[model samples]
Target: MEKNEKNEEEEADEEFEEDYEIKILHGYENNYYDISKPFFIYSKENLVNFEILDSILPMNTSKNEHKSGIIECRYQLSCFLRLTRDVTEVTNNLNIQQFKYILMTLKFLKAVENKNITKLLQVLIFNNFFYQKDYKLRNYNLHLIQILNSSFFTQIDFHLKKNIMSSFLNSLMIRYDFYDENLIIFKNSKELFDYSMFSEHIPYKNLMINNFDAFCSVENILRDSNVLIIFQILLKEINIKSLILNNFFRHLNPDENFAFLISKIEIFKAFTISNYKIPASPFFLFCLIVSINNNIEYLRLENISYCRLNLRGLLEGKKLKGLILSKIGLTENASLINESRNVYETIEYIDIQGVFLNHSIWHEIFQSTNSSKIILHFNNSDIEEIFINNLKKFEIQKNSVLYLEIKFNSNTLPRGFCNSLIHFKNLKTLKLDGYIIYEDTESLLYKAIYYMKELECLVLCQNCRNTKPYIFLLQNSKIDCLDIQSTSNNNDAIMIEFFRLHKSMTRISIKDAKVSSLCLKEIFKQKNLIHLCLDIDILPPQVDQESLTFKSKNIHNLDLCNNTLKYIEGVDILSKLYRVHTLRISKCNPPPGYLSKLNKKCNSYVKILTYEYGILDFDDLNRIGKLGNLLKLNLLGCKFSGCSFFDLVTSCKFFKSLKTINLLNSNIKMKDFQCMKRFKKLKRAVFSFTEFNLLTLKNSLASLQICKLKFHTMLEDSNYNEFCLYLNESNIYILRG
Candidate 1:
């Protein structure tokens, strides 16, 4: 009895297991099943045929049992039967075989719910049984329905949304029915069409227009700090249409727009539309702008600031027009902006300030454009190859160009630049300051000056040292107005030779130059000089005792300040320079005889004498008192023993012509300066660097009627409050040391 009861329990358990497996498979299949049957059922009520299904039921099966058994067989099967009945009721009903196959597919799907079973179903769907084209046995629509109803369908939707779907469909189409399947599947579902995957399957390209939000999402993803992977993936998939690519870049943050992108496209049309703050990349923006191969006529990048960009490759392009890059800090290659193959035809005007450009870049730019107007205000020490190359190019276009201004700081002129000047054929005006150049290059500089046949005005205001020899060589070079000052080089021989060579040269200046009798002799050779600056340490040369003479009569003005001459025996010869209207001789040790002779000789012209820091006794002053034409007198740095020198100056009637008087460092007491007021024409009076008491001097000078008073005192010992008050009260431009 115990064995029989156990056997009964075992048999029941086995029956339960079989039923459970069938139910589990049915549930799995139902998950992937389409629920479109309800729509079909609601739409096809007129074509519903209950008679067609009446003959299919088994005998003795009640309506309730038939309905329950059908529904319980499999969820997919019940869905298919319902869909078939709905389709039959519709006007265009599905055929019998199609309907039956659909039902069978639904039943098969019921067993494919398990992952292992679903994989097996996928293989079966692609194999001969389901994939064959023969209508008698295999049906593609039925196969598709079965596969879609399996659990694998849900996984497909999750993993292969749109992109993967397209990729998978494309791959299958390529492998089977290459042309036909690709066209059919692509037409049905474009979202599942990947061009790369369908290359072998179809010749037609499947491209989608980039959506606005899609572009924004890509840009946002790229902008995030840790989205490099996303950016790379998007880049790979993104199409190269200009509009789409531009939109993607438009949303990038200002600081994120680095040089990496600039190096790739070269042209940024939207640069003017968006004010994206540029990244602080080391490469310069100008280099990038000039390097792009595309037409840049309308490119408007206003405030792009960068350090330097390589422009070596950009020199081959057509000229760029109206290029404006200002207030940029460019390093090493600023000159490259002007260097292009056809730069002359394109670029017109350029203004670059506070940019650290290499000289070679400038050389190329100048050579390429022959720019009519260029303004470069650079303060750099190094000289580059661009300087020489540019000069050569400038020389080539000298006839047509108008304005060129350059301000740079250097210890000497750059190498080869002096020689390159020969190319300035039509240079009208040239202004140079603080240029350090090599001595050997000076020899070649004459070639540049010789070529500049139309050079009119030249200004060498500061620091002309290494090129003095070259300047001397350029004496015959065409020039009208020449201004030379503060050149501290021992090239006196060269100066003399220059004067001798350029006798036709109108304006000549030897200010603050160490000149001797030999240099003065050289000056005598220039007969047509209109302006003469002889302000030099005129102490007689150690070897020479010969008296110097100014035989030229064309001298209009002469500055003979800072000279040492005790005797005026040479004046008889200087009296021949009758064209000299203004004569200045300061800081000289002149004897009574010399002063008397000078006064007698210069009686017809305006004479100005400055006696500073030397023994010019009352005798000398008495002699100077005889000069009736004296205009201005300065006695700075002089030692006087008594008030007799001042008395002599005050008594002279010619002193009324005095316009300025400087008594700086002269050993005269403040009370003694009271005599200066006697000169009615004294416009400015200077009492600087003197040992006189400030209060006394101010009190004495206060009574004098003068337009300007300059008092320079040692303020180190002065009271700060008093100094400030004095400065405020006195409406003067004061400079204290």
Candidate 2:
């Protein structure tokens, strides 16, 4: 009976897992904190589709947190809205839009439930999260004072008033002490925490006084808690896996609270500190390394100038699985070899980039490591003949190394390095960058790949070698992913020969290698290709009588950039890729009626279409409207000055499923912006670097329920004030240049 019950539970879990998916959709071209371009969380099964105003906010992944934030919101809000005493009836009346707002609002409520609003304000101020938006408030300190002295304060509940006063006072104290010590306005606002300000609310008079007294005692500590408090809150609340400190510890010293917190909490699985300049004392660095618990698996240091020898203590515990050092300055190399020999047996991954290491030290570390499965990434580092000879002789890395990337500063490999690559028999992924492999070395590299029976992905970038090395691996190897970027000119014939020979690569991205139409024809014949990205110049079609037909049915994404079509053959080639769901064409000059042809071929297949830095006339816009399945339309930097925006909107009337439209740096008229309200499903719109008129902006504010709107860097400075005023009236203040 227990076994039968276990089987039933497993079946139920499988069913649930198949139906649930939480996806995050980022904006077209915006950073995390831009409220005008917030990330969207979409989930169909959970009824949790909403916009997170701050994209960098930690996602609530724990079951308890998710249940409390979303499920509790539904429960409490339903209870409050129960008119007929039926929760089902109240919930049924609410639409998906209403549920979105409810979820967004309750997420904020859950945040402020445990954390004081004042503390959050102080944290944002210290972390510079609000530096961009604070200026839009126009003397934010004065604005806060105006709001506090308004009649709105007299309307809240007595307990709520006391809580507000306490939070406001605490927030002001932190700003005055830490954020800007020289600001006279904050110094003046520091006098508002007195007993006279709260005498009207006698119920919590003594409580407020005690709170103020407690805050006063910690005033000195708060001044030194610049960004440490942010990290403390994150470490306390979230189970972070990686702790990254970039450009940190310029001259600041850690307080006692931070030291205590670091000692108490379990160390992160991975820790990284990069771009550090100031040299810290050896003892201080030793203490910091000793504080980390044995749970650490990865330690990364990049561009650090301080305490290179002291950082060797980071490998002391013999528990780390990965060590990544990039552009690191080493004062003493002999000590690092000794430290690596102790911990190298357990390390599974090693990435050393731009670090000057002697040949003996490299040979010693490489010879000592004995991990079962290892990944080696070496970039621009010294790997002399001794190390390469050792690799060929000992073969310690042969059966263990699964991933290897060898990138050199010059476009040339060390002598016999390509021959030694054959020793990594278990390599599943190999990347060789900045290497101009000649025909002989290229043959050797392909020969090495032939021996790597487990190789699945091969990437060769910035290679100026004009050779068809992939031809050697076509029949001998079974690599499904091939990425190549050539810096030499006129490799179309070589590429054409290779593509004609191979048809097994499931993903192919070749950049900066100009290919003719004939070369593209050969690439399209690969039936297993799922993604094809070519950023080369597409020359005019060559004389060929053979039909140019696409053979791949699995290709869902086709990205073609910097291609100028001088003939209709290129358009015909693109029209043949009708199976693609996402088609991105940038900086391409398509012949007239290109969209009409695409609409006829891919009206039902394409869902996400991006055409940037091209001309889109009225007829083209009308043809785009016929693509009924388009979910996102990105026309960034397209010349539409000659086309009427209102006509485009009215012609594209079948965008029922469209959710996002980005028109950044486009010639869009201000009055025609209100016509976009016709697309009811449109949720996010970006019009940055465009002109805006206040009259149409007013109408757009009233009519459009756009969850994310961006009008940053408008063209005309004359209308900036009025445009900003209208946006402020609508409470859409998340703007950035």
Candidate 3:
């Protein structure tokens, strides 16, 4: 018994030690590659930077063409305006005139950013650089293109038309920071011909060659020398800015074909490679990155972090700007960072997460960034403290670092640590996460927060079991923005006091807190609460369901995610807000027939209803259809097998109101939907993982404007040819399984 106790104690200490500091962080996976979870929160959606209107909006010509151009722009703008009036319109119609759909969407988004029409849409679309909206938009376009390409290529005898391929590539090129979710839709050489032509029209800058989705190996995919020729053509034509060869190392065959492509495309502005395993000497993609993207400015290496390459050969005369050496370290006295200091003083951004750099070594690395600003991300509070304390050692000019984000792993920072932050008076943003605090932690920490008088945004998160209400500590804070996550709401008084203290906060994320419906009433009282997220799994019994309907006219977005609304009394409270524009509900199975009662009681002005993963019945669909203003209805992974999908579609009277009916991972039949009369209002019907027969069905899909179908059963050569022939004659798109 004593031995077991000792072993358990040792294990606990080890766990505590492990959590305190992360030596090497997979920041890439956390930020971009995690396909399991949604990339952004439901309320705070990351959108594209439509502010690049100058680039996307038709360029101005001479004064002679200005009037005619203005007329043309207005004409184009009107088309976009019509599309944005409802989400259904854009969703339903994208397949009909795909080029025009993409072009108008981009142009219309410029107006949305400018708030030219529809005040509700203008607010939802923000083009903030910090949000990296352009990246998200590319991902959306890529996913769409993946679906289109999968079906479109199967129809062609040889390859895609240049005009068609150019139109799609142009849509992908709008954003400077390009990413395409790297969905390699090309199946054979014929499709590769279309992909090869992409750089001919637009300035192809950013690219991720392979996104190891299901296809981990490049074995069967690259059948011959045809792909290599295409790669060579792309490199010679386009000036590559950012190149990401992630998920390529292990799968890349150690052959002359792979080596030839590597040797061909050698220079880029920035390069990133993550999750690569070192095979034989043939696995020289890493060497190719250093030698090739030869004009390298920003370089990031994750997972397989270390290399025995000669640092002098890689860094000697290069003007490198940013370095991300994650989860790996410098070997021996060959500290590459120190060597670079002689060439360039400081790299603009150095993100070192999951790796422990001892204080002395870290200080040397910190001193080498540019004067404009040095953006650094550390996952350990100890490392963060080391950074905070070592600021004086580095000769960074005053106000050089205008913002600093300090993220904590587990350590509740020492009081002096907070006090030390004020020295960097220009610090505008501070974020602390995962650290739990108790009553005895400190009141002085509040003074520490107060000292950063220039701080504009503060995010405090504590969701551990021992997390206590710590709102009183913010009494001295002048920060206007707060995102707090608490574990317990035992003290209603404390929560009320918290709202009272920061009553004017513009945005907030309250999740897993002991906040009940009554506490939410206090939250609704905030005048500037434009965005409110309620992610509680269960509301406490003390919640006042009969809580008075509050008038929060400013509130535009409401996200009720992963929370049970079955017990909540005032689920209809949202109906009272006329300004509510977007409502997202996910992963909550309510009691049968609850949606009908709620829809009748509430008249929510929700324009977009994004529903995912709840066994919704036909009545639920009927109830949702009853919403007077619901424009777009997106159903993902929800079973509709119990009731015929067409029965639900035919029953929906808001055919004009709901423009898009996208069903992914649900059960539906092709023949039943053939008699889709009411579906005329729907511009598009996307069926993914929905069981449908394409072999026996004699269904005419032309009635439903534009339809998309994904087949399940593998097709024989004759069947594939027949399927292509059938779809080519019809408006329906058959996406490959």
Candidate 4:
């Protein structure tokens, strides 16, 4: 017994020494890549000085004309409305129809000095350099054209397109400081084509390639010359900081590929391999990442099949800062060691998205840890019952965890999980989804939650009706954001009580639930709520619309999506809210005079509005045209006479702030779309799936202020290529997915 205790003490000291070495290596200078940031949060603030809009509006444009034109002197006033009137005019010398192309090229030069290209776009647009182009300027123009073709020009004859793409790449390779850090390769046919065209000029820091959802055969991928060249280049040259290989890496020669990767393992910081069947022993990857030469901070292996991963050795590692294992399986009848040591002291994030593990492996992860700000996500996963029991028996405390999510996948919670959660007292955000809870466990959950003093956000999803009354028990806590879903019938009383108790709620989302008049009245009485999302069922037959006035004047964003109601009773109260500027309503019929009431009450206040899959009459169009601050109007799948709609909007004398208009799936007369030339502030126009009158569109383009156009059609294959080439020749920026 004394020898066993001494052995255990020696193991603990060795683990501590290993952890100290890893912490010194990672030294708080670099931040781990946050995979949680949503993709829609485009950091547009980085390029505000450049005139590029980086329009994310879903629009597509198609036409038949291919003639390029010169920048007209008359376009100065319309294009530079934001600049002073004394801005110099170009001498009609250069033909630059859309200035956004230059803007995009400058944006793509991520590592280039911004001061050199700071005024480059404005000078090219407002100067005479295009006509009397010097040799250097001509080369620059060729480079931009090549980039445009490779990025957006997706016509056929890819082999021939590579010839034109080489000049720009040859120039780009000379600029050693300007290397692409983030490259997405082989995710789709378009991305594949782009890589094929630019494979010879490969320079990347962090590469992400996906073959799981792509419609590409592994045999064809292995035979592709471009893929081979890129792999060879990556092995020899690129010091890849982060690498993601999805599904296709398993088919290659493992010996050669693994050898080259291990040769360059010292430079790798993050690595992910997901959704494939591995060979017998998976320790090749595990050993490579955790080897002494490599300090890989993040490791993710998801949905791996046919493998017996050595969990004991992986858990003993001390360098990994983020570890994610999702739906991993072991080979049948596989045997491993039933031993565990101290948990990883350097791990700050552990996301287990569904894995089958025994008590020992669980103990290796939850046995002990020294991290102070760990973020753990147990999404759609199961934990060992013995592990939970051991946690309670040993009296282990996990107060270092800051953000915790326990989202089960159609599974019952282990016996003592909820009772054990009171140990996470420092938790700030907690999400519980898709669990089958009994009344006793529910009470225990509330009791555990009441101890979380630092908790600010709580999300409860699935089986919420059973969990409703206990939710109000959180009112004593200081949670400012609440999200609840799957509340069944007659939840109005519960919601009313919740709102009354938690009047300080700032952001609320109640989806897949039902609420009545009394509940809505209580909701609007909250003076602090800023963002509200309600995807509820039909309102009751007897709603008092007169009583539903604007009590919450601070609400800025209101989303009522997927409602089955024909006419939402008190939706017109949106017009009376002083600060409610953004409204999104989809798949719902409005009440009698919805827009007319808005027009009369507060037409000039609303800035962004979207009404999709509904009908808009003539009066609705007229009223929409008069919204003074309206910047974006998306009328998707809404039927109306496009001719009359455009005429009313262009004829409006009171409103000119509209910058984007999306009329997708609407009946449009492109001949009357020419009337859009009268709206000088328009930056993007999308009329996809509507009529494409080529002649009228060309006639309108000369006078329009749009920098981006989204249009396409169900044309013959030959005509589509010609349409793409024509747009490229005409200098109109085309967006690719």
Candidate 5:
């Protein structure tokens, strides 16, 4: 027995010595340890010791107690002493591992001393502990609280201490209700004694209210009349459960009449009634109610069945900041005169959709507000008459409005409206939604374009069957951004001419428009164009190829979607666009070695290259590997099957600069992603489909420290529970699995 005791004692000593060596080694090398290294090393080595210590610690009397009483007691005591010493050393080391150790020890100690630990541990638990090296250590508060019961806490005033109070407040802001009920107990303890604690906890009611008294304390905070009234409004807006509502009402005692007035406002009723004339459904009414209760200012009245607003009484109000009246059937002489006269000075945003505003109403509006931004939707109005009558009125008040949106449904714009636009010299952003330029009005459009020289952005959607007017506008406009969607065919020459004339255009989009080789050649000559989108039916036979041979490469984002191109040569043209970063080719078939040649030519400058809605076989992956500086590669809706794509991604060690790899809606597997960890600089990864298990992917990605991670599954059989577990374990930002 004595011999056995001596052996056990020696073993304990050796264990203690090993722990001491580990603590000393960690302390000495703490400064040198790199935080960017994978966390698995620390988890395996350091956490294993903690687990072993937890096993040996005793909390209750048991059947095995007598069988190994003396040995177990000594072993437990020695292990505790070793852990305590190690924790102290780690805390002194001031590294990520030390911080993690401190948190882990606190958790273990709290668990062991449940209902017995002193108040100091509780206070320590509330304090903001910074690892300085490990960002993950910030989320350890819930775990600490979970292990310690409320009995361990003392009646110390939390608000009086300002050192780590902010940190404690932030901690209370997070949800902690898991399998354990100790968080509930702690919250209830705070509520039962201290009214001051209620103030700090009210802002985070969604986080804490698992226990009984916690709800009442939150109600008390809400009942405080001196507090910001916005809090009450926000509380009502949040979809609190019926149980919570009942608890709130039970403890709520309002001294002032404001809360009572707010309660009596019948927020839901007001919302439903206000939108009744606007043809909104009950669901929409609820949304509006929630928005209004939350004081959300930005409201869109699109497609709402609105008649003339009964604004005869609205003339009394002083501040009418945001007003949206889109798709409302207000006549030319709607009862907006009084309202416009009263709050027009205060109104900042005015949206008039499909409303017939005659000359007099326009005159009144222009005369009323000096700095309001107007969005006029004349989709089904007699725009010509309105424009002719209101042109002089608008010109006189050019300094009043900053932004204008003129949307027309017809293909041809009224000559009068085009003529009137020339009068507004101070227009900042002009969105001409539909193709509204007529052949006859081309001169007027050009004149308006010249007049609005101060215009920053011009959006002209080619909803017209004819593309000539749009071509005219693009060629003449000096606007910074030219977003044109041409619906007509056979306008490639006009577009080429337009770009040739306007070399300083910043962003241009010609979706479903034809562009000839001459047009591309002219476009290439303009190296100042940053963002270019060309959706041509056919690449200008072979002539365009020659033009591309001398391409000027200043383009940053080149989106060639749904273009007709059998082969893409003259990639040498891209060498001239030195700043080109993103290249997108969708629904097009190029020559077999076209992309490969481009990749080889561009080398490290190409950052993003995406191919969607097309066939991308193994050859494509091999070609993609040649772009050394490629950071983001999206292969959505592509026909690349099997493990070849995976192999290509894994083997591209030169793709160390790669940050985002999107393989959504592709035929890939979970196993295909096993080699992703090789990319050390990868920050974001997206995967879709049920075949890729979120839990498996999350576990695999845990070591990557990915900043933005997304997982999407189509199957109803997906394991959301396991996915959430993995998400919680890993510190990934976004989890959509």
Candidate 6:
């Protein structure tokens, strides 16, 4: 009987994941207080002074801390509503541990009842624990069905019903083996779906389903209604990157509403299918193409995100507007030379990250892309031989300009390519990355620029060999901006000369430039140079600290990234620029003390600041709160904790002026509608690659009906019919890659 009991509980453990690790207070007991902690928001009767709380916690408080020996389920109910117990126990004495126990009891109640069950079952499903042995189960004593099914829950709002139902399922998943299988509530649902079939679970991330490839598709669980529930949840998450269909098509029921599924997934406006994966046959490809051929415009193929693959032709369904084809490794021996030529004449943009083709295939690709912008990234040194004769044939499209992003693999470029560039007098922007270049190009590249009077922007990125181009562009081109990368001591002389002619140059950016601290003095001499970015080699870390103080009076924008630094002397020097409105310190981990120096010196003039890939603490938040004119903040990919980031924003006066914010790739919690509730002037926000959740997120955020940013596909719920209707009515622009 004990063995049977263990077996039943093991089965229960298989279906539900264990609870997440509990949160411990960040600071130690003594360190936590004396600082004067605020009272819990829900329990505070009024704003009262806290004489410091106690110094330590009792051990094993994970066990209930209530005065009674057992956990009072009624206490858990109060916390479910975000409420807490009385503050009568606030100890003025530092020695007392009473207040600590008060917090522990509240935490215990919060943990026992606030079981995010849906998330837990997700772990069990993916980890494949049902097939394992000796897994134990723990049960919460509350009868969830009795409480949720009561008249009190029945008359509640429909969304609340869903939440309650979800809570019941979460608890049920963990306690299934412990509960009597013959219990009244263990019967069939209104849809005749049997609960005894096992509890449904959905993953937190987008469902990464694979049969041979999908770990979730085990033992016919694919047919369960839970699969649809997970899909429905994913649709609401708005994380539509790519939905692989390999396992999807293989195990799907023929009678299923695939059309309805397709209709609900209207967020997908781009598609890619590669022949490299599992060797998909032409016949199956044809059927797959026919099924999805109607809606998408942007298409790419193969392992192009990382590598390359075979060129798959556009079929008879939808005409692609932009196509990304990479590493189309066609050989003379291949039979499908004629098969790959299904080009769409209407296509406008083409991006080839890598390509290896003979003359005929190369000609066909260029002919296919007659769009306004064509970008190609190639590492092959022999591209000149492939296009030497053809370069001259390329026309300067009327009213169109040429832009080139050239990286040198060898000093020897096709001798004719740079010579041929001059023929297209319509070249407007030229960006050359010569990190690997050794040969001098100032004569040829500069002479070409001298002739293209239409040239407006010149970016010399990495190993910019000679100074002549900067000096020559002064008279030859209608240039407004110059972005130079990786300057040497020789390039500093080039900059010295360029400054003499940069009175009309409004923007300048130089990265990894090995120049002295005095270069700022020369840079500040240019009256019209409003924006400047420098990655100087600040050696001896505190080079010229006391003597070299920042004093740029007119320069308005500054960026200092990609360099190692030890102090704020450079920023303190640069902060003297009264007009400098945009500042970015990114891709480098400068100490927070360095940031503090910047905040202290330039908080008033700097209107926009972007910091990335660094440790972010409340100090940074507090400093950002001091920037009086800050209009935009892009804190992308920074490591930060605490749920009250936005709460800080609303309370601080300096952050009131913020108009645009990019929190991409960050974990942000707090209601979207409530967090931005105070930023009335806030018009735009970029939250791509972010996961934000709150109690009111789905309801309140979606209800913003007129989310001035015009949320058309913003709510990418998995119902396509409704999405399509919204799309038809929406005039809002949706950006796609």
lDDT of each: 0.44, 0.53, 0.48, 0.53, 0.48, 0.45
Tens digit of per-residue lDDT, candidate 3, span 1-737: 00001232233323221211111111112233232542221111223334333342243345353211111221223334344443334332232233333333444333323222222222222221012343223223333334333433233221122222332223223211122312232211111111231222123355554433312223222232433333333333343455555543444445634332342344556666666665555236444654554466666666663354343455666666666566554444445564566544635555566556666566556555553334455666666667656655665543555545445667665555555554566656666676656555444444456566666676767535433445443553555666666656554566666666767767667666556665676776777766777676435555655664454556677666675454353546444555666766677655444454443433456667777776777777676766665656777767653565666655555665555565666554564555444554454455553333455443445444444555444335665567667876764566665
Per-candidate TM equals 0.40, 0.53, 0.51, 0.51, 0.48, 0.44
Candidate 5 clashes between residue pairs 3 or more apart in a chain or in different chains: 413-436, 517-544, 553-576, 553-577, 554-577
How many backbone clashes are present in model 3? 19
For candidate 6, report its TM-score.
0.44
State the lDDT of candidate 2 residue by residue for 1-737, as single tens digits: 00001232233323221211222333223233333442233232212222332232345356454211222222223322222122233322332223323323334323223224333333323222223333222233332333334343333333333333334334434332111111111222212222232211111111111122232233333343432343333322222345444433344344522352332235356655555565644454455557666776777676766666444566766476777777776666456565456777777777776666666556655676654443344454344333445565543656787877766555455447777777778888888777666665666777777788777888888556555535444454567788888734455666677676667878998887766778777877788888988776656555342556667766788877774334224436565565678988877766445655563666787788898877777777877877777878898887754565576677674556677788887766665677786776665678854555666667665655455676667355656776666666665544454
User: Ranking by TM-score, best first?
Assistant: 2, 4, 3, 5, 6, 1
The digit string of per-residue lDDT tens for model 4 on 610-725 reads 98876677767777776777777888777763335665565474345677788777666665577777766676777753565555666676665566778655544654566567
Q: List where candidate 4 sits over 4 angstroms from the true fold.
A: 1-189, 192-296, 303-309, 312-317, 329-343, 370-396, 413-415, 471-475, 488-503, 514-518, 525-530, 537-543, 546-557, 562-584, 591-613, 616-737
Error of 5 at 278 (Å): 16
Error in Å for residue 17 of model 4: 43
- Model 5 lDDT tens row, 431-547: 777655556876677577666656777776746545343444553466657776764545665666667667777787767665566766665566567787777655536454554
How do the residues 326-432 of candidate 6 rate in per-residue lDDT, one tens digit apiece?
A: 55453343322354444445555565655655565556655545454455565675653565456655442423435555554443444356677666577676666
lDDT of 3: 0.48
Q: After superposition, how far is residue 70 of candidate 2 from its true place, in Å?
A: 24
Candidate 1 lDDT tens digits, 565-611: 43333545344655456765566554433333343445556466655
Candidate 1's C-alpha runs over 4 A off are 1-396, 400-408, 415-420, 428-433, 454-502, 510-522, 534-548, 561-582, 586-596, 599-614, 619-633, 641-645, 652-660, 676-685, 688-727, 730-737
* RMSD each, Å: 38.4, 17.8, 22.1, 19.4, 16.9, 22.2
Clashes of each: 30, 0, 19, 5, 5, 9
Give, for candidate 2, the lowest lDDT window spanning 10 residues. Answer: 177-186
For model 1 the TM-score comes to: 0.40
Which residue window of length 10 is worst by lDDT in model 6?
A: 183-192
RMSD of 4: 19.4
Rate residue 15 of model 1 by lDDT.
23
TM-score of 2: 0.53
